[model samples]
Target: MAQVHLRDVVKNYGPLEVVHSINLDIADNEFVVLVGPSGCGKSTTLRMIAGLEEISGGEIFIGDNVVNDLPPRERNISMVFQNYALYPHMTVRENLGFSLKIAKRPQAEIDKAVDEAAEILSLTPLLDRKPGALSGGQRQRVAMGRAIVRHPDVFLFDEPLSNLDAKLRTQMRVEIKKLHQKVRSTIVYVTHDQVEAMTLADRIVIMRDGHIEQIGTPLDVFENPVNTFVATFIGSPPMNLLNGVVRDGAVVLEDGTTVPVPPGYQAREGQAVQLGMRADNVMPVGHSLPPTEHMAQIEMDVNLTEPLGTETLLFAELAGAEVQAKMLNPRPVEAGERMTFQVMLDKCHLFDAESGAALRG
Candidate 1:
């Protein structure tokens, strides 16, 4: 295992610079996931760390070795790609041991290494089968096993679960997490799925437009986002944001509904701000949750309700915009009906309307 560090790393293509100067430190044996939307330079950053993309500026260090000019192979890192890049003609055993064979290891050494990798990934039964005969998830395991035989200092996963079906993807996620716990290698995984980042990473690096938006543990980022973008991005169903103005130490929405502003929030009366709340923090009175700081009640017209087994997602109009909230142990309700819900103002977030930044006291 190794610690990876990037200092002012940058990527440029002619006159256009896609990745701005970014710095990050990845500790030894830590699983850090880079997550972002499409075209956010997340994958580019991962490739740069693997030495697959040339840095336009700054230095990259993998275990105290400056690797800015090093090739991917020289970095002693193994990469698992999204497409399961396996050799169709080679059996799983041969595929896993190919790197060792190319490095001139003896047959016994290759066999031992291949066996170990297969055992780690539960691919022992499929060792004799070729990639053409394996399922997508099995083939992906073969790809990871190939990387394992090399005993790399770091592992880079470029959306390795993207090719599998939803069920297989969930299953593979557990397997990957188990593999990490067992091997304990430093890993950098890149994916667009926030759920993947939440469930897999020790810490998540959220990137946007070539810049890092936030880096925090899943719960940390979800509970206290730095801005509207982050507040809306890290959680499922996103956060509900309502435009309002500060008045008499509280926020007044467009429709004259008021929710208390948390004490010590730096805001002046008549300031334009946005009130943010997560779905879990808001609930109908009957489906009660304890209040945080202050709880304010409001009635809105229900537009939709989606029953998600354990909870039902309710969509209603608030401050002229549709906001979503969750109802746990929910009872059925008809659309277009009026209903009352409580907003937990203490758990709320406030953002400067013009800058979109969280208002700090």
Candidate 2:
């Protein structure tokens, strides 16, 4: 395993600069994921690290070697892309052993490596099947097995699970995590899915436009987002945002609703801000709400309810904005009914209205 480092990395397509100068240090054996919306330069960055795309500026280091001018074959890195990229005419065993065969490795060693990869991926049953007959998930495993055969210093994945169904994607996410533990190799994965990023990464790098927004463990970025963009982008259902102003040590929402400011906050009396609260933190009464340091109770009309088996997602009107709240151990909730909800004030986030930067105390 080797550490991957990027210093002031930049990318450009002729006159248009896509990726701004970015700096990241991925520790040895670390499973780092680069995630963002489409065209955010995540795949481009991954390609640069794999030596598939040329860098416009700065340097990339794999362990103690400077691999700026190295070709893909010389970089000792294997990349699995979104498409399976397996040969239709080749059997799973052949596909896994092709790279070694191309390097003129002895047939016995190639067979040994192929068998080992098949065992690790549980693909021994499908080894004789051609890519055409295999399922999507199985074909993807063969793609990963090919990479495993190389025993590369770094493994790169470019949204490798995007082509699968939701259920299969979840299963593969767990398989990929186990693969990391079994191989103990450095991996750089790229994806636009926050669910995948949250579940599989040791640390996640959130990108927007062409710049890195924030980099931290999934929980760190989720709990303490630096800006409104990150706050809304990193979570499911996203964080609810209510535009308002701070007055009288409380936040006044657009519809004249007032919610207590989070404790220990320092802001001007009349400063404009956006108040944010996660769905789980703000729920209807009688949901076993925890003992929060600061909380606010408000009456709001329920707009809709989405029952998701274990819990229901309640949508309601708050300060004239549609806010989503979670209801665990839920009872039947009808639309148009009035309900009293509690907002966990201590977990709330405040951001400047003008710049959208988090207002830290």
Candidate 3:
């Protein structure tokens, strides 16, 4: 395994920069994920590493060698594309051994490597089958098997699971993680799906508008987002953000309710701020005593009740705005009924109303 480093990397199209000065260090055997919305330059960043896209500036290094001038083949990297590009005419064995054969490796060595990879990937039974006869998941394994046969320093995956169905994608995620554990190869994966990023990444790089927003572990970015954009982007049901103002060391909501601020907040009294709280953090106050002495409670009409089998998501309105709260039980509830709920003040996050930057306490 080899470490990958990107130094102030950039990409442009006639002065329209798609990837801005991105600097990142990926350690050996570390699974780093590049995640962002469409047009946010995540795919561009992956392509630059794979040598499929030209860099307008900066340098990329694989191990101790600078690969800025290298082509895709010369970069010594294996890429698994979203489409699982496999030659239909070649059998599974031939597809897995193509790269070695192109490099003119000995027949015995190629056979040995292919056989080993096949065994590890459970593709040995399909070795003689053509791509046309293989299932989608099997074809995907072939694509990965081809990569494993070469044993490159870095594995670059560009939304390799995008084309698969939801169930297949979930299955593939486990398979890929297991494969990584066995091989312990350095990986750089790109995906727009936050679930994939959170599940697969050792470190997540969240990008927006061709710039890096935040880079941290999944839990770090989820629990302590750097800004309002990240607060809303990282979670499934997203964090609930309400406009408020700091009043006498407390935040006053739009409905004129005061909520105490956490200790050590730098923002002074009367400053406009945004309050952020996760759905799970907003629970029925009486169910369990909250950790924070200062609690913020709101009375609102329940708009909908979604029973998710294991848990229930309550959609309600607070201060003329829609908000969601997740409950541990699939309790019964009705819409259009007023309900009072408490928010955990200690778990709440604050952001600057004007700048959207998170306010630290």
* Tens-digit per-residue lDDT, 1-361, candidate 1: 3999989988998988888998899999999999999999999999998888899998889998999988887899999999988988899999999888888999999999999999999899999998999999999999999988998999999999998999999999999999999988999999999999999999999999999988998888988788899899888889999999999988899999988885546787899999988888789878867666578888888899999988999999987898898888899989998888988776789999988888867
Q: For candidate 2, give the lDDT of residue 9.
A: 93
Once fitted onto the true fold, the runs of candidate 1 whose alpha carbons sit more than 4 angstroms away are: none
Ranking by lDDT: 2, 1, 3
- The best-first sequence of candidates by TM-score reads 2, 1, 3
Highest lDDT: give the candidate number.
2
Task: Report every candidate's CA lDDT.
Answer: 0.90, 0.92, 0.89
Q: How do the residues 1-361 of candidate 3 rate in per-residue lDDT, one tens digit apiece? A: 4999999999999969888899999999999999989999999999999999988999999999888889999988999988999999999999999999999999999999999999999999999999999999999999999999999999999999999999999999999999999999999999999999999999999999889999999999998899999899998898998888898888888998777774445577888998888888776545434457767776768889888887788888877677888766556887887777887777788899999998885
What are the per-residue Cα lDDT tens digits for candidate 2 across 55-117?
A: 999999999888989998998999898998998889999999999999999999999999999
- The superposed Cα distance between candidate 2 and the true structure at residue 131, in angstroms, equals 0.8
> In angstroms, how far off is 314's CA in candidate 2?
0.8
Output the worst ten-in-a-row residue range by lDDT, candidate 2. Answer: 287-296
Clash number for candidate 1: 0
For candidate 2, the lDDT comes to 0.92
Compute the lDDT for candidate 3.
Answer: 0.89
Ten residues in sequence with the least summed lDDT for candidate 1? 287-296
At residue 15, give the lDDT of candidate 2.
95
